[model samples]
Target chain A: MPDLAASSKRPPPWALRILVLTYLTIFLFAPLLALGVESFREGALSLWQGITEPESLLALRNSFLLAAIAVVLNVLFGIAAGLVIARQRFWGRALLDGLIEVPLALSPVMVGLAFILIFGRTGWLGPWLSQFGVRVIFSFPGLIIATLFVTVPFTAREVIHVLSEIGEEEEMAATTLGASRWQTFWHVTLPNMRGALSCGISLTAARALGEFGAVLIMGGAITGSTHTATTWIFTAVDERNNGAALGLSLVLGLCSVALLLLVEKLRARAHERR
Target chain B: MRPALTPTSRWSLLLRGAVIAWMLLLVVLPLVALAIHGLRSGVPFFWAAITEPQAKDAVALTLWTALLISLINAVLGTATAWLITRYRFRGRRLLATLIDLPLAIPTLVTGIMLVVLFGPMSPLGAWFEGHGIYVAFHSPIIVLALGFVTLPFSVRMVQPVLADMDRAEEEAAASLGASRLVTFLRIIWPSIGPAVLGGALQTFARAMAEFGSIVVVSGNVPHETLTAPVYIYGQVESGDSHGAAAVALALVTLSLLVTLFSKLMVRWGVRRHA
Candidate 1:
């Protein structure tokens, strides 16, 4: 409606198009190419073998276990939060929506530091939990907490937008027909968010697997126990084992790519549904 | 539609209240605690540490680096978003997914990816080092490397805005005899300007607090390359709890300001556009 755009334009001039393309190739593909090449180099096989060693495999196991646990937790809680914020016209709905993005904006290091102050030995709840002979810091539980804190919002934000668009009309109609509340939600609402849920979970899992800053602070990079894949990579680098670090990183990178791809595909499909 | 007065309202209200409560108590309260503890640890101690020439140097350096990284991403992220939204070239969808690679790739993995690609033995690393541009480690390469991770946020935030831009408006402008540059400047830029700035602010926020990726690549040299977050970690490890608290306070405040400012900017932008 603005007249400003009602001006003339050449068809994305050759120079401009070339400029954009050249910038894209340099900035986008260059660093990626560097990694893609090194990921399959001569020593990459030996590095792979090292990453599969028992200790290393344990790290990989810890990473997957943590991601699975966090993703499932976020999926349940995030969707619930999404539903409430999107459907309800509460006094603080806007506030709640904003709060959902807090973790996403926060740096991982800050999240880790917060976890320590709340759960570490000198932490607020640290003394409270110590009575139960439970250690919160330098433990696997701490790693999961760190991962969960940083990843909790991804699913919530994704699902909330989708739910808001899909709306309460369907649920209302189903309930009007004498469907049970739970039945209506399952039949009318759950089906509407399938792709969004998948994309959200994929992002959460991707984040959990790649968590390093929060995990490092919470677990002190402890190996074989609290060691996640990211922390393990850092430890390898600290020990000057670049190849081992590269091998672990390659696996993590691939997982991230796969999740991002899935999310992209779902986003495309979700747009069609809406 | 279903009747309004159902038990579903009660349960949904309860769930929503719980979420708001949880976020406030966990995320907001800790940030509050971080500030109070940071200040309570003593203004003298905080000033003493931060006022030292070296610490001041690190702070200034970090700010500039974050600014540079944010600026670079603002231009590049917007261009990339423009390309993805406007074009149907080969591999277009793939590029969209790949641009977000950093979001899911975990910051540490990103650092590791760079390490593999730029380490001395790798061809790419050797090429840079050979050219007297040693970007591998313990240099400004840390800023450049972390830049990759933060680029996705800016692009993701701006892309949708760009996509929403009415191409029909631009075409009309062209019909009226405006050049491409004129139309883009007067139309597209105005619509997306504040949004891009909002996204750039976010990029700046994340870059300022970036620790994991920078820590690995910067070598964490105390005066030369130690960012505030890394500095805090050192304090914790060295048992300088109060000093750590001080640094943490500053970091938290900076991010809090950026977040609040961006939110305001976004709202202002919306009102103006409306």
Candidate 2:
């Protein structure tokens, strides 16, 4: 391959490489660096105080709780729907597949709006739910729903891709060996799906954690009660409390980067297994 | 012939029903409710709501900015992908990882990072302002934020196509005295064109619905900087659910169209490959 490439394709010009690097620096790297610098500029004490404040801590906790719930729900849906789509012949199969991608295309704000229309004060279900003393919008449940909606595609798509690639041979063999359907799934299909499953989970977690717009609207950005880290950052910035905003931004940013690294590792492992 | 992975037992039937129900409740029903609510005030009222000057400007700004960003990503992402695939350089892995960073980071943090780097208080931002080029809290920042969040779409879309691409044709073209640009246009472009287009369209769809980062970075100034999603947020916040839903519906419709077209492009590409 190296010989073929050397004989056929010349290295691209330095100018193009420089241009690409410069663009990335301005667009991605420099901004991230700026965040790190600004966060620490006020010294470690201020940064610590900013993040450890009651509101900021609550925001972080809320974000993590929502992300955890979203991850679990998405994984469940991913596996079930992935199996149905990949292994079963069903009515509306194509429609289900298409609908899975809808969340990806719709803006997060639209998602929040969609939920509010279904659960807000004058919404279809709002009055009924209120009668039961249950709140959906402007609460944690709303945050979870919106996060779940946006992160839905990641896991299911990954599972579907893995299932198609792995095929049904193992499961069919298991059945021929007198294994029940559940047994075949648990012993054969699930084991084979492990790598892809983890990959999907990581993707889901990252997306759920980073979710902002939908969560913001659904949670109503109320300080201690409904605010997630993302929303809190918005509020902090709005109030000119750059310290708190930068502190939380750094924390979330680092968490995202860590998740991204894990995803890359999982992806590489999946490729190796393939 | 392949056997069924799971025969239609009672268990399988139950699982399928549960999965379908879950999807309906989690994804489809809310969207249906949104559509109904958006149009509940009648077509004329919905039309008037969306056509209001502020709403119109927001939608227009979102579309225009999304279009511009998609075009830019198509070009730059291609270049970046080409560099990654064709070169064996130092920090190549780092560059690839950085490309995926936007996907991992919470977009609200992405906005904050941009603000930290280019807000009026920052040295770089102050320098730019001295020359009358306002980046933070201005229209230009919208491009940067959208570009940051949507960074990986085209590059990831194009990377695999480039990697799997056969070099034989290019070698032949080069041996036949074809220029690098000519070879690319004739041989490589034809193969990767659909992927690039699909990626760009996906970027456009995603950007149109982007909110979190833009909300913070663009400052959401009514007629000047507000994008559709942010405008919808405002409408919802200001106690105008119907108007918000109306605008949300329009954005959703446009996104659905773009997503379908992109999926079609992918299918067409696969057919051509097969």
Best model number under lDDT? 2
lDDT of 1 by residue, A1-274 (tens): 1122322333444654676667555545666776777666737677777688776788899989999999888888776787778777767778778777777666676677767777778878889999998887899888877887888788888889888877777788888888887787778788887777898999898988888888888888776688888888888877877566778888888888888888877877776565
RMSD of each: 3.5, 2.1
Q: All candidates' lDDT scores? A: 0.75, 0.86
Candidates' TM-scores? 0.90, 0.96
Screening candidate 2 with a backbone cut-off below 3 angstroms (N, C-alpha, C), the clashing residue pairs are none
Cα error, candidate 1, residue B230 (Å): 1.7
Instruction: Tell me the TM-score of model 1.
Output: 0.90
Q: Candidate 2 lDDT, tens digit per residue, B1-274?
A: 2343544666667778887888898889978987898899899988998999999999999999999999999999999988888877667778888899998898889888888889898999999999999998899999999999899999988887788788889999999999989998999998899999999999999999888888888888999999999999988889898898889888888899999999899888767866
- Candidate 1 local lDDT, B56-155, one digit each (tens): 7667767888888788778877877766666555665566667777787778876766666677877877898888887766556777776777868777
Q: Write the per-residue lDDT of candidate 2 for residues A1-274, one digit (tens) a residue.
A: 2122422245667987998988788778898888878877867777788899999999989988888887888788888877888888878889988888788888888888889888899888999999999998888888888888889899899898889889888888878888876788888888877777788888888888788888888889886699988889889988988678888888888888888899889888777666
